[model samples]
Target: MTFTLGPRAISAGYQLAAFDQIGSTNAEALARARDGERGPKWFVTTEQTAGRGRRQRAWVMPRGNLASSILEVMDVSPAVAATLGFAAGLSLESALQKLAVEANMRRAEPLKFALKWPNDVLAERQKLTGILLEAEAVAGNRLAVVVGIGTNVVAAPEGTPTPATSLAALGVHVGAEELFKGLAEAWVEFRGIWDNGRGFAGIRKAWLDRAFGVGEPVAIRTGTATIEGTFDTIDETGCLIVRTAEGKRMPITAGEVYFGTAASLGAT
Candidate 1:
């Protein structure tokens, strides 16, 4: 299937570049940004040979999966630009909801699809999508950020760190192109809501509403130390707020979060 940006995405100043195969969409996008390609563009590929998730973890990108990256040059600082991960996560959640509704496969319970802390989208507590955000400094204090997203549409990798599932595994027969269409359109809407990180309060609220393990026990691993606490709310800067057993609220800026006794860990 040919990948194309929807009218909504184009109207919102998004350009599309589709590839049959690539080493890494995020890498290509960043390379282009460094060469003075200041674009709000989408770098999409059917297959990625060298894709990576957060913390340099290997990202399995099968041929039928969705491997795409959004590159935007922003005036915001790198710290502020990092918040776009929340926007991307919320966008993916919205896109999945739309796909489920279109297939008439809505879950009876509310959280059939939910967002994990930092950057994962889960379907029934199993990971369905992963998000990665990378940023580079440009001339004159401008920063360029690339939001990379990968979704398991037809198949999920086996023996992953966390339990994995796909749309096909869930009995929803959707193609990567179809999913990307929804994702592109939904991204435009969510970007508008984000307003370049100025409107983060609404994004934070929406993300928490669909959060997978809020108010539940979670274990967060940051390097050598592991901290177990109750999953609390996210702060204004999009940090995960974990309330430890000692009644202290610790805001985690980066870590691997595991929920509900899941020993497996994934990057956040």
Candidate 2:
């Protein structure tokens, strides 16, 4: 099946560039932006050869996996642009929920999906999708932000810090084409709620509703040190609020996080 944007996305002035295989959708989107392409456009592929996750980690999308990126040029600070990732999280969460339901029709057991702090979506407590945001300064004080989303439709990487899973592994035999359709439509809904960071409060509330590891013991490893604390909440500015044992609330801007038993082991 051909990959295509949903009706709502098309009506919202969002264009799409679907590829059979690409090195990295995020890289392609940013390159387009650098070439003075101001767009609310999507770059997507099922087979991504080279991709990168947060903190410059390699992200591989094998055949049948999904790799998608959307480009949005806006006049917003990098701080504000960072919050847009919450909308991306919500979009994929909504899309995956629908697919999970359809795949588990006659089964008594239902698959659970949740958003991990920062930029990941979890299914059955394992990482299923990774969202990466990259931005570059453009003319007229506008920032070209590319939100990249990679999902494991048929394959999952082995020996990751956080365990990974796939839709096929969970018996959700859906295609990448179908998943992208749901994602594009769902993005239209949540992106409207985001409103270019103006509506982050609404996004924050909704994200917390589907947040994973909240109120659980977790550890965040930053560049200098590792902080072990209870997973508190995400603040208004999208910072993860971790409450230490001393009852101090520490706001972390970026870090690698581990929850439950993984926290105890100090997985990095």
Candidate 3:
């Protein structure tokens, strides 16, 4: 009754690049690729002066947190490039499980962590990490993309909307080097699913399997429009399929999915 958890340690084909502090990894990766240099993996740190989230929001990246970007060469289309964040989310969850940090688990089940639509990794209903992925067209058939991720490994800063948790806070202690190494290894498997032109079907399945609040009531915030509906499921493109009050099922490709009770939703 034994099983292997970790794959044989192999180079993730990443050349480690570090910075004392930087504005952003996606910026650096795109800049490096444009400058005719190979987009190597960068372990960015030092103040994270201008870290950001999806949609240009300021990301609160305190020192001692996990913030880095992996630049990969791909032949993926623009549409698929848009879904790369899903692949990275899947990779992050797998690595955290290995480190004995269950992001997706309940007291009855085993997986408490879940992925928010578009680009967020949640832990205990709080955000443990977030990702920002950007793809740029290269000269020929190649697309240079940077998958930047930030994890609160040590602690989180104050005044944030959501409560943030770290691996250490979850009772799983490890250093930055080990955490990054295992994460890179998991990304290799994710790259396979992406490179095969499979779109987000595989990633969607993996995410749904461990996702929180699926088939439940949810409230979504879409900036202009706020909707409350039953969380039916996610579509092939990783969009949420929710049932609205008017007996219509809607597709939510972009927006925040939040869980709520049917009683509360009835008031909406």
Candidate 4:
């Protein structure tokens, strides 16, 4: 159950639990967090059989891939939980950057990837990873939050709603045991940025750095009526800012973004 981290993570004292299979890491992590079993001091799971992402979507993960969840209790307002996924997105983006370099993935000219608002990682516009945050009301005074992440280290199943890619496809052969610890460590750095009333200015800055569609015309579906707008930027709370087709600046809390491109379609 215990997986060893590479030398890079050892100095940081990251411990990971590896699983051959599981229904969902986020679900398991949430249950554990509710039991007082999470925080910056602990990291869980190296791989999951059935991972999960936002809105209960499937987080398809293959063996030897990055599939784990970080459990933490936050002071965030549940009303804004939809936006908090951006923090996790920022963290994973940094981790992937490190992975890409360590594996010498850049030599292959892999398509540059970026974070899609809400919760997905893209490679050349196709999804390479996704984040899932689950929370539950706890007794007395605490809420349980689990940040589950899934990345394609080897491959994702075909016939998924959108296209997918793996590290291997980009010339990076990242093994599960070798990658989880670094991912855990990256969360620690990001959690620090999230805490301390800093809001998401830093996360937004980094997100915007690798973000796609900042100046492109796009549409976000709110279900009742679609909002067509031009992509603007991210705000302090990590919410996406868009200029409505009417030229009004709008902060979108929730929706599926459509950018008329393959890499932007993202998740199901």
Per-model TM-score, in order, reads 0.95, 0.98, 0.84, 0.84
For model 2, residues 152-176, the per-residue Cα lDDT tens digits are: 9999999988889999999899999
Candidate 3: worst 10 consecutive residues by lDDT? 1-10
Q: Which candidate ranks first by TM-score, i.e. highest?
A: 2
Q: How many residue pairs clash in each candidate?
A: 0, 0, 8, 1
lDDT of 4 by residue, 90-119 (tens): 777777777777555446564577988878
Task: Name model 3 segments beyond 4 Å from true.
Answer: 1-12, 38-42, 101-111, 261-268
- Candidate 1, residue 133: the lDDT equals 93
The 10 consecutive residues of candidate 1 with the worst lDDT sum are 102-111
lDDT of 1 by residue, 137-184 (tens): 987789989999999988888887778899888867888998899899
Q: What stretches of model 2 exceed 4 Å from their correct place?
A: none
Q: Predictions ranked by lDDT, top down?
A: 2, 1, 3, 4
- lDDT (Cα, 0-100) at 263 in candidate 2: 85
TM-score for candidate 3, residues paired by index? 0.84
- Candidate 3 achieves a global lDDT of 0.71
**Runs in model 4 with CA error above 4 Å?**
5-15, 41-47, 79-83, 102-111, 261-268
